[model samples]
Target chain A: MKIKREYMELGALATLALVLLVAFPLLLGGFYLNLAGKYLSFAFVAIGIVLTWGYGGILSLGQGIFFGLGGYALAMFLKIEASGSNLPDFMIWSGIKVMPAWWAPFSNIYITLAAIVLIPATMAFVFSYLVFKKRVSGVYFAIVTLALALTFTVLLVGQQSYTGGENGITNFTTFLGYDIYSHASTYAIYYTEIVLLLFVAMGSTAVIRSRLGNVVIAIRDREDRVRFSGYNTAAIKAFIFMLGALFASIGGAFFTIQAGLISPTVVGVTSSIEMVVYAAVGGRLSVPGAVLGALVVGFLQFYLSNNFPHIWLFFLGALFILVVTAMPNGLMGLLDRFALSRE
Target chain B: MELMQGQQGVIFDGANVPAARRGHCELSIRNLSVSFDGFKAVDDLSLHIAQDELRVIIGPNGAGKTTLLDMICGKTRPMAGQIFLNDLNLTNLSDFNIVRAGVGRKFQNPSVYEDLSVAENLEISIPRGRGALASLFFRRTKVVKEEIRDMARIVFLDDLLDRRAGHLSHGQKQWLEIGMLLMQAPKLLLLDEPVAGMSPREREQTAELLKVLSVGRSVVVIEHDMDFVRSIAHTVTVLHQGRLLVEGSADEVQADPRVIDVYLGH
Candidate 1:
């Protein structure tokens, strides 16, 4: 029987999920598992990049803003909960007696969860409307998003007391009344991240196969054709961009939970560009390729930082250039060509 | 070609749009003008298309043939003028809204999505639940499948529906684009240079397709191919220096002395 390409993709995703969710946890010890969890969280952002930059053709250079927002929202809530009516440690250290008015809503876990999804999506919606509605696209859109990331990083760094003064929010103890530092909690968080990643992968695949995804691709290729076909191209672009932001925000929220910290470094311009590199290295157009890209890049960064230390950045830069120049479609395209090769 | 079941009812939602008079003039453009810097691309051009009319526009390279279609489809905003489809004004509406208001345009170059298959291209163009949410949850129902199949057959692409549009020949891409436009079931179809890169056999097929397409709809075609226009044109409109020189049947327009001096003679 002839197998459809989409089915083959689904099979590959299932196998990957089985390995990551089942085999990795059973085989790897605590340290490696935790590291893998961190890498998997990056996969969320990579998947988002595929949707926005890869599919919708809206290259957002500042996905870190959404990720940071989601991470901070959860971190702020946890910090407040750990304070037990006292000010968060950073506020007290900075000599502020009162918690800011904005931080009050994050005290409720429900609200923080909602904010994790809504905040980034809202930012995306606003930015996309302002720019895409005006018919701005290509490099102009990229520059605007990059500027946004830079400005936001500066703002977070400048607001030292509230944002942990560049050191970022750290020292987590409890989450949802469970001890997050314990081995069981670490395992739970790892499993949770894996499950969420799989869910996002499947959901994104469904979307990419849907009419929405088709139209988004069409708009990416030929915007005027899509617009003349009676589609609100701006709205479609905005929606996909917003979805990308939502995925990144979710990833950010998990990053804080897994790493026990939310820092300005993660939301910086360098980090945003790094996230794009992950997508580009994976296969911008392939969701699974994006996930693998994040995993590979994350693992390489970990290994390189410990082994080569100073040379890691240069290595990454070379990798990016090579991927762009030599393999424009990234690792997935390479794998696809191999799969289609019949000698 | 017959429309799919349940498609005709929603073709024009009278509640949100003005009712279209079947036998009357379908598209009315009044005093339309758009200038780039001080250069007039289109200057005070007025045109009318009765229901089911196939109007062919022939002109020189810079005679504003494309700008005319661009203005009608809202790709380029006109400096002064009103475009009315049926009784609804379409001048200030955005590109997508103008399309939803019953005008589908095909660009000079075949603009179908290269990455998508021919069927998928037609599916996206079908105006079923066009909102972001609607498209997200869109399912291929029986009507949608039949509509796609019927459109594919109409465009001579039924056997190649699963082929990627990028893999198609130049003529096939043109047919695919026309198929996509027909999927919308648009009342006014604006085509710009549809046969620029087509073979002679393909041009004959397109002419036949356009004849059937204009049965229940109005078509405006801009082309440089005089032989193709002669075979397909119901009325030929000559444009020269951003203005209409003459409007008559194909033979009559060919015989006009001013048309010969300005356009055909050169």
Candidate 2:
């Protein structure tokens, strides 16, 4: 039987992911595990970018808005839980007596979780519907999304009483009755994040390999042709974009729980563009590549910002330019070339 | 159904289509006019195409041949017009909705997905799981696979199904695009300069394929190749300055003095 190259490559990737997931926890401890957990959560957003921008051909530069929205939602729930029906410290500091109506539903964990996914999905639906209905796409769509992120950041920063301002929602002591600060809880979060990341990566691979994936890519290549071939182009784009938003939201939720904070800084234009860079460096079209890109970039940022804080920004800018020029397909493309040459 | 009943030419309601009028008017346009800025691209154009008819549209460069197709396919909405595709009023519909109403369109350029394989390209146009939820868990059954193979066979790409569409020769890419359209099983196929870049041999094959395709559907071919048009066209519609100059058999159109003066004269 002739083995398709795609199947072989997928098999190799799955094996690699399995090995990494099982071995990483054993090799790393304490601070490293916590850091890896955070990175894994960030991978959710990167994988989402792969599905939307890479596959669907919808480049959203404001994904930080969705990520921030999700993280903030979960953070609110966690905050209220920590507060035990009382007003959060920031709200009290801002001289607010009553809990905001929006913050009331989040006191229930299930509602908060739903909002974490629904908020971004709803926002995506409204935003995508309006934009795509008018047939606005390409760079215009990117600019709109970027503007949204910027606007959202400003709004979050300005609303000190409701949003806790630039400091964001923080100082959470518990998550679902577990003492999040305890070593056992941190390990649980790390393991859960790793498992979720692996599943998400696998799920995305399945999606990209499905029949819908072909149509999505076709829309990316020749949208008019796909439309004339009887597929609703805008609806398809909206669906994929919404799915991407949901993934980012889920990642945000995970980040809030693991890191014990959700801040406006992560939802701003800078971090939003950084998410795309992760996808670009990993291999925008490859699911596993997106995950690897997130981990590598996340780790590098942590290390470089610590050791050479002043040079980190310059290094990142240079690296982005180099990757875009020299390796447009990213680390996966490089690895693919090496593999093909070896073969 | 309402649009089909009130048209000038023979019209068939989709549900009650008579056996004798199987080739009834599939597409009917009335008083269609469109302008881009100050220039009138398609001015007061009206045309009726019957089912199973292979109608060829020939025009000079700025004669609005592409714009006509664009309007029909809902890529460009007419400033004033009514377009009916049997039971559907296609004038106000979006491009995809118009397509769903059984109007398939091919552009002047071969526009297959370059990054995908020939089989994948064909698979995308197979009208299943069109909704978001259904597409999420779309599974390819054996029947769908066989159908894709059949479409590939029709386009002469059965052997090249695994090859990337971008790697195909220009003629092959054109055929792949036509195959993609065919996979949707549309009632009407609007081809805009399909054989524009094809070799004579490929053109001949395309003509033969299009003739076979017209057995169960309507086909509108917009081409500059008079020889190719004469070979397959049952009727020829000549357009000069976005207005219909004449409509007749191939020889009649070729011999028309008005056609020569306006289009062939150039």
Candidate 3:
């Protein structure tokens, strides 16, 4: 690998990472490919935190709100597309006469995809503007956003007729008249998912390397100084929040396409917090750290549960605690420190 | 558009302040008071910083000097007072807004992000100073480059632009903070202990830099180093118990009997 000397000698590691990213999805068996796809989506959420929370110093736990909202938006579209003549699987059980008016716009694939991007971006724009403009920061900021995620999930669960209540919009989605249940179709979905995942990673990396990326870091370290320098911080933060939300939504939409299902639990508060853990484990500033965090956590969740089903969660908690206290910088930070010590 | 940034180039005199009226919008503080609960950290303070004026504030530990700077920078809101920056009202604005109103501040501790490169720190503060966005498309505009170059030249940081701010010397870090303030290009620059932990040589250089930069903008510096205060300060303001003890030329204030007895406590 061609290494840049100044990356703390990390350029080789980054190149090796790129090679593995492209190769892993291809070489892994069908089961692992699906697993990796899920990991990629978690990374999407991590990137969101990296931008708004990590770089801009806005600790937004409410990212899951956008993540799930994007999931639901796309899920609503797939259900409508699949319904064709018969009512969606959940709607028949819920005893609804006809589809709701809100579901009508999603009937067009173009509009649904547009809504997927536009709606979430717009919401982030408004929400972030309000919070940052008020200068609600630190512990209070975290609590408020966490509350937003909780309140949003509760709303999804409460809207029985529209949102399918706690069950969420699931048992729907077919990619252009093809049944997604077959193994071949899943493989196809897997490759497509990989492509999207790569794009998301590359896109985020590009942004982080750009000039505006500097502002995000500046905002994180010194807001007073930055503001005095003449930047509209609230506006910068809101813009980044919206961008992060759009990425998560795209990830969520990909997630739905793969599973042929959508539900509240996947995008719930617990899941939102899980994204935080993944980012933390991978280390916040390291883009690759997020992927590593998601992959390791996901692998552990899958493997440990299978062998030690009863004590698995306890093990996971113990692992997380160890990681948090001992390796606050996460796996990447540890690796970096170890590498530094050697050099 | 390109040259507007150069208009404020390297000078310390606040007279360059673009004003609605004939005189520039130099900083004016009247009866400013800040309290932590009821402690009155800064009480009934009034001061003014003129254009291109390098004014040094000195007091013993816990004398409310830092609090005075904090209030002016909009980091802390005073219970009662009016702050006019070039005649623009600043009483109701938040920290960011006040920063936008044309005031720059350097923290006592190095606030630059260690994880980021020096160039990255420069890039981040510049867009804000130039009123640009942190979007993907925001390249370094011509004005941004000129401003960054000008700041780098003053701090002798031109060669270390690509290096991380974290790896800098104590002196370099102080210069980086000042560079950040220059990116802010505020009419009044508020510095908190610019050379608290530097070597004697570094402190002397900082003293010289302050005197050099004070030609076109208003600057308020807080210092414990008596010599530094004497060297750079055109006017001296002594703060004690969050209030002003006396204000005049550095020598006059130093010789004042009241300033020594109550404010300096020497």
Candidate 4:
């Protein structure tokens, strides 16, 4: 634990939340527990976004690719298991008797887990290596990462025969013999997600506090100076990009279990953009800020759509701008200021 | 110290750059040119630096002095021509590689990591490099910590060791930057406006520091401070309109008619 003293404060908070999460499922009942499970995954996604945008000073707009990859890993295995005939139902329904070679890896949980972690990290690596190595930063970085997300969404949308496509792969829930819809199962998943979220939050805190973190902030403040100081800036950026992707994929994997499905709609261009929005709305620096931002945004969407579903995205856009234009550092900054003044 | 052991009453003013081996090739530039878009920032310029000579490049504004330093340090590549350092051709060398090859640079701005404590900043500077992770595990094994402290004492910043670098006064920040560069232990130090905004007393002390620094290493300094340049430069290379107009000893160059005209007219 002392190997990383950087994230100690955030670790404390995360530990507190984790205890609450583990206990809440049993105390609060199944429906609410599943909703809380959804929150942890969302928290992971926000932490991932923060690593790039908040710390590395990278403008990544395509976190959805990793999220989608994680979701697809679980979805593919679940579907394959459900079919019980080697090929998932979609491939058979589309007149393709053979499963794609790419889908073969998800049959084993180890491979699926590796895919959950590595695929997104790899995507981040390749994309960020190409971009940051060329010194593409600022809005240029934003555009390229967003473009990647857009491409993934388009690919998923068109691949209806293999994937579920626009309608998405949803319903028929169970993971490794546990019923996804079961009350205990929901609590189990929620607890697992909370643990993952705690780690991401703690990991990011350590990263920001480490010497590597100093280099990150230095790169943010003065890239030319860091370069002159003999750091391979592109390599550092790649490292952070991969780290962010890992967090995003973890969130995506948990997202699949909570929602019990995977599809293009959930992990699309807009979803990628929404990741940035959460970071921006979360104050972009603190781990707690990201978690808070995700929770607030998630609740806002859930409630607004529950009332007037048609204007939900519009409300989202407006809220984002309002928060950005006014608060700048998100709700935590606001809360901190309020508490300070009162004291 | 041994160089002067053979001679009696040798003056030590940091003006001696280490002598190069007869044919080692320290740095060579040929028809180097760099442009931004259509504008010629530095055009058709060429220069050579001896193995360990501390040479001062003095030029007026827009003389491409900074740009020239940039080329030497691999911060910018020439649109035309090649830059060579020792055995290696450096035109294609990346920023970090160039530094790794011992071509370190200090910018005019004091760009130290602001939030880090002075000791922490110094701790990071020891150049354990690329994988500082392993270096951290073996921090005490390295001599960098002691060296950093020794350097702080040399720079007269030993007392400010625990203070954050950002809290330092302007001149103190500068000494910290120089200390950071010293931590690199570079072969050829490329300095751009090292004493631009210092107080008079600070400027005098900096001139003294530069003099001490020139004894054993090669330094390519871009400076507009004529008096400071006069005090420290072994040989002054005057630049005008992105060209090397003349090169000579400080006193000899100051008396040159063209040098006077360019310095006055600009």
Candidate 5:
């Protein structure tokens, strides 16, 4: 009976995929479709938050660091390709006569793709492993990650010559010589992002259902007990944290593609906290709920900011407060309660 | 004194004699000492546990009984001591490594994963697939399921396998924890007040369970209930103020002047 409930949840995910794959493209126009793509990109981060925060019980307040790393990785490649044999325009403007050795690696598409995933994953693993090894967790771990976000943003903004400085890496028009702004390419990217998001969600679900997932949950609850059970609780947490970073990095790469830029603004302390809000509002424990949360919250932010620009931040704060205090389980919890009542 | 298999199948009458003469010791602690703020919690404690022996430790409050177990399980690093499981030095090993080295410890409180199902609680304790990646891909085979079921039966939780651990009664939770330890198949088990909250009926069952569990391994239990100690203990070791006062049968310890002075008299 319990297993059936799990399968039913998977069925809900399949239904969600069908709606994203079919319904959204049919109903929404080009601009709305693009906006939807952007929100879906954020869903990557939300899914990651679900895994790390919801399941593994590691609340990372610096996911923006990984997101920025991924965005910058892909943006660097695009900027180099667009520059075509000259230093990227920012470097030239900053009086850099030669391409930095680090920038050279981004020029290769394969290396850029690999870097987008690997860099954030390695950083997350090493950082979390060291911290968890020393038994630093709970709010302390969160503070460390928050500081990481702040530090990353400062470094990005300070590196004017190599990283494009406060303006960030932008004005890239093509990916591998194809026109990215063209209507067909936009639709193509949107479809690719949707498919990848669904795949990631499925993978996350499989992991949550696995034995490792059980151990992660156990560690979250009674870490000492799990340790006494002969499991390396630190390594388990690090692995999940790394997976979360991997997902966020992929999302950042997609955001760079869909939004056409990467900036410190999108990869700072505020943005990282906002990423967690997406998970919290969506239902941290539910993978599909995370995607829905990103979309709903993303759309609300867009709509509210357009209409009442100055009040949007306050509105977001209120919503977060409401969710945490009144509905701690988020939208998924509500849906679950509703379903249970109906049954 | 000669070693004999009692009605319980394994019982040591005089384990205080040096362990080298009677086969091999399963756990050896030598001159273990630890102090906090100039106050010794466990001081100069040297003890040996033999194979297939169920030893009960009876002590008053602040007697360092739990602290001694903590040192054995690597939860507490002794200022000076050596702990050995056979020939393996366990004093410096981390908690998880010490657990892997064949020592299972149950805390004073029931510490089962309350949110997990009884089956999941047992399954997570299986010694295989301990690595992060290994566990990610670990499968529940038929053999594993059967093993879980058999263990549940032993702990008298077979019917509650699918129930959430939080919903279980106190005695059930304690049994689930012991079941978890049995899943590790540790050579030495350290249990602190295993029946602290159990009813008299549950206490009787736990005593039986401990006797059955000690057949192939060494079991050390700390208890205040003298009746429970007499029921399951092969030999009794008494600790008072971070030191061993006496080691003997329950009847002998009950008659000892030192044991009566520090503990039983109260």
Candidate 6:
């Protein structure tokens, strides 16, 4: 009977894939399709949050740090490709006569792709391992991650010459000598993003269904019991945290690709908290729900900000409060309740 | 005694023998001491538990019964002492490593994973795939499934296998935790007040369960209920002010003046 529910979840994922891959492309215009691609990028972070916060009981308020790391890693490669033989335009303007040594590795596409995942994963592992090993968790861990996001933003903004500062790395005309801005390329990129998103969703589902996922859930509820059960609770938590970072980084890379830029504003503390909101509104336990959450919330944010720019923040705040108080499980929880009552 | 039938391995029959005379004890604690700030929670305590013996430790609230279990299970580091489980020194090891070394502890509270099903709780407690990577790739083999089912039956939870642990009655939750520990197949089991919240009938059933469980392994329990202790304990150790007050048959300990003065009389 429990297995049946899992299959039903997989069916929902299939339905979601059909909508994203076929229905959206058929129904929406080119502009809306591109916008949908951007929302899907944020969905990656929301899915990662589901694993870390919803299941692992490790609420990281600093996910933007990993996301930024991934975005910046890919953006550096894109910027290098756009600049061709000269220093990136921002570096030239900032009076930097030569490319920084750190940026040299990202100039290679393979190295950049590896760094997009590895850098964030390594950082998250080391940080989480050190903290969790000390048995620091709950609100204290959350605060530490929040501080990390703040510190990361300050560091990026402070180092203007190398990082492109607050304005961030932008104005990418080409990716590997191909005009990325062309209509055909844009559609291609959108389709590629959809495929990658579905692949990641499947991977996340597999992890959630595995024994490791059970351990993660167990740790979330009774960490001491898990430790007494002959498992190193800290190591398990750190591994899951690293996995979440890996997902966020991939999303960050995708975000940079779709949005055409990477900025401190997009990867700062506020943005990290907003990413958590996407998970919360989607139903943090459901992978497909997270994707739906990102799309629905992302579209709402766009519409509200455009129509009622001054009150959008208040509206978002109200929505979050409403979800937490009335529907702790988010949209998926609501849907499940409806389904259960119907049955 | 009939519960001892069909048991394998060495079953130590000399429950009354002195610690120095025993050839090999399953658990040996020597001069164990721990202090929080300047207060000694457990002070200069030494004890021995023989294989297949069911020993119950009874004490007043502050007499360090739970603290002794804590130190033995590696939750609390002793300021001074050595804890030996067979040949291995468990004093300095981490809690999980101690568990891996074949010691299972049930806390005072029924600390089973409430969100998980009864079967999953048992499955997670199985000895294999304890490492992070190992757990990620761990499969539910037929042997593992049988083990879980057998353990559920032992704990009287076979019918509730798919039920969420949170929904179980308090006594059922306690049994689930015991079943979880059994899944580890530990050489030594430390239970802190196993029947703390159980009803009269549940307590009697637990007593029977413990007798059957003690056939092949050592069991140390901390309990407040004297009747429950009398029913299951092969030997009772009375602790007073972080020191051993008495060690004898349940009736002898109940009759001891020091044990009564410090614990039961109050």
For model 6, what fraction of the real interface contacts is kept? 0.93
DockQ of every model listed?
A: 0.84, 0.64, 0.43, 0.40, 0.80, 0.80
Error of 1 at A68 (Å): 0.4
Model 1, B1-266: lDDT tens digits are 23433343332232233224433448999999989999999989999998778999998878889999999999899999899998989999999998888888999999999999998999998887799999999999887887787778778898998898999999999999988888787889999989879999989988987876676678999988889999999999999889988999999999999999988888
- The pairs that clash in candidate 4 are B14-B211
A71-133 per-residue lDDT for model 6 (tens digits): 999899999999989999999998999889999988899999989878999999998999999
Clashing pairs in 6: none
* Model 1 lDDT tens row, A189-262: 99888888899999999999899999999999988778888988888999999989999999999999888898
- Ten-residue segment with the worst summed lDDT in candidate 1 chain B? B10-19
Tens-digit lDDT track of model 6 for B147-167: 677778778898999999999
Q: Is candidate 4 or candidate 5 better by DockQ?
A: 5
Please, what are the lDDT tens digits per residue for candidate 5 over residues A1-343?
Answer: 4675697678779988988999999999888998999888889999999999999899999999898988899999888888988889999998999889988988889999999888999999998999999999999999999998999999999998988888888999899989888988889999999999999999999999888989999998989889999998999999999999999999999999889899999999999999999999989999999999999999999999999988888999999999999998899878877776786
User: What is the lDDT ranking, best to worst?
Assistant: 5, 6, 1, 2, 4, 3
Candidate 6 wrongly placed segments (more than 4 Å): A1-4, B1-25
Q: After superposing candidate 1, which stretches have Cα over 4 Å from the reference?
A: A1-4, B1-25
Cα displacement (Å) at residue A47, model 6: 0.3
In order of DockQ, best first, we have 1, 5, 6, 2, 3, 4
Candidate 2 residue lDDT tens string, B1-266: 22122232222133244424444448898999999997899989999998778999998999999999999998998999899988679989988888888888898988889988898888777777777667768778776777777677778888998898899999999999898887776778999888888999999989888887775578899999899999999999998888898999999999999999888878
Instruction: Give the DockQ-based CAPRI class for model 6.
Output: medium
Candidate lDDT (C-alpha), each: 0.87, 0.84, 0.74, 0.75, 0.90, 0.89
Pairs that collide, model 5: none
Query: What's the residue-level lDDT of A174 in candidate 3?
Result: 73
lDDT of 4 by residue, B196-249 (tens): 788988889888877676555567888888888887888899888877889999
Candidate 5 docking classification: medium
Candidate 4: residue B125 lDDT (0-100): 60
The window of 10 residues in a row where model 3 chain A has the poorest summed lDDT is A1-10
